[model samples]
Target: MINLINISKSYGENHAVRSFDLTIETAETTVLIGPSGCGKSTILRTIIGLISPDTGKVNIEGEALSTANLVSLRQKMGYVIQEGGLFPNLSAEGNVFLMARYLGWDKDRIEERIDELCELTKFPKDALNRYPIQISGGQRQRLSLMRALMLDPNILLLDEPLGALDPLIRSELQQDLKEIFSTLGKTVVMVTHDMGEAAFFGDKIVLIKDGQIIQEGNISDLIKTPSNPFVTTFINAQRNHLEIIGDI
Candidate 1:
């Protein structure tokens, strides 16, 4: 459903992504996992058109992304950035419907979509009027997911969607999010540092370092048949944490 061909992005001397090539299958969840500053998030942003690659191309479905079709192609994607990225001034409902309203959706259509999202994300109808700051971190994330899905985009891009929440809340949301993903079956690409989270949500995991993929496969593939030493080291580094939940 999505492809990045020979993509490269650099900032001064630091290379954020380098010759990265990936194909995200339709209706499947692909997780990008790496340490901080390792460029997984950069790849996600590039796919969403927030960062234009200095080399290569981003293809959505079949069309090549260009300045002319950036906006139109972007409408086919739903992006949820870190910490929800909700507008502080807007109520939860407002944030969710922001894009819809901008696209000139009618009041009835907006309200109907809002209700569906609230139920899908398990968000309370009563809290729709609340602002981002007024809600709990988990609720805020749910609202963020709602906002992303409001347009019913074909692809969902999430960067550390649950990173800001406490562990208990994160666990709860993970379960909820897994169910939501299964229910919707949208093509999903997400970035995270946690191996457990990646294993839980990812149908395919791409482990990256220094802006390049060290290994890309299922969790068992990385664990039982590592591509290199770094792949083993990366897994062992999180072994204890992963064992705590018996997730690895």
Candidate 2:
């Protein structure tokens, strides 16, 4: 499990996140949803130790995330960023095997792991040899996911993983991602502004506004029991009512 307590971050005088607190349970998928600049991405980065919070603490599986343990802690969490973030110079297989090689896994084990991940992610066999630039955006994103999972991390952090894809591809990959997460049973935290995506993929939805959590709960609970006018307005703006009421 990942836990954040009173987490906050700032740049010069501008605060990016303020007194944020969240708990992501093991083997569950949590989605963070809000308008732009609500600090959703910042929360993911802070949890991964990429961005240091000015205040509060982060704990992963009961271990505090400190400078001394950041490297080891990060090795246990898979992170996928927007646009796939694959290295253009590396082949898909190379990208997936990079971390395992760095961790001193033998050649035979790395090859086995690569083949397993390719099968698990359902990428074409030929895709293993192709560079990121040579693959479609959706394929690249899958490759990115494969690379993150190569190390077999216990947690996954995805920051707008499908934000760059076309709607059709986004929808397709969303299903693929959901299936993979369900099969793997790894804890996942995803950040997105797309409310439909949030409702579809998240077991728990956290709504943020101006760097604060306005509300959080199951999708049904939030839709049926909005806490205030702002929550209602935000939900309406996202077309959540369509999801709640179903199309006529």
Candidate 3:
């Protein structure tokens, strides 16, 4: 559903993305995994138009990204960043309906969407009136997810959505998120440094290194027939943890 072609970006002399090319399939989850500063998030931001590549282009459903179409294209996408990115001042319901209200959605329609999202994200109705600080970390992330899905966009872009949570909470949310993605069948692109998380959520996993794609495939593909030495090294580095989670 989204494609990045020959993309390159640099900050000062450091290349953030180098000659990158990737296509995210429709109704499937694509996980971008790498070490910190490897540019996976940069690629995600590029797809969402937050970062313009110095070279190459991004295409969403065959439409090339440009300023003229950026706003319209963005409305079709739901973005959830790390730590939930919720407004501390806004109540849970307020945060979820922020965009809907801005777009002039009628009260009934907004409430209906919020109800659906709350149920989908397993957020409590009683907590809707609470602020972000009043909720637990997991609940805050759920609220972030609700806010993203309030518009019912066709694509979901998440950058380390579960990175900050404790392991147990993160595991629980991973299962919940996987079910949500399967139920919705939206195009999903997520970024993480954890191989276990990638294997759990990704239908296609792209392993990146030094601003370049080192390998792209299923977890088994990377384990069995690594594209390069770095691919093997990356996998082995996380193999023990992956084994505890079992094969995907």
Q: How far is candidate 1 from the true structure (C-alpha RMSD, Å)?
A: 1.9
Q: Can you write out model 2's per-residue Cα lDDT over 112-217, one digit (the tens) per residue?
A: 8888888888888787898888899989989999999999999999999999999899889999999999999999999999888998999999999888898889
Give one digit per residue, the lDDT tens place, for model 3 in 3-81.
Answer: 8999999999999999999999999999999999999999999998999999999999999999999998998899999
What alpha-carbon RMSD in Å does predicted model 3 have with respect to the real structure? Answer: 2.2
Per-model TM values vs. the true structure: 0.96, 0.95, 0.96
Candidates 1 and 2: which is better by TM-score? 1
- Candidate 3: where are CA atoms >4 Å away? 241-248
The sequence of per-residue lDDT tens digits that candidate 1 reaches over residues 112-173 is: 99989988999999999998999998999999999989999999999999988998999999
Clashes of 1: 0
- After superposition, the stretches of candidate 1 with alpha carbons farther than 4 Å from their true spots are 241-248
Candidate 2 local Cα displacement, residue 181, angstroms = 0.7
User: Candidate 1: lDDT of 129?
Assistant: 97
Which stretches of model 2 miss by more than 4 angstroms?
Answer: 240-248
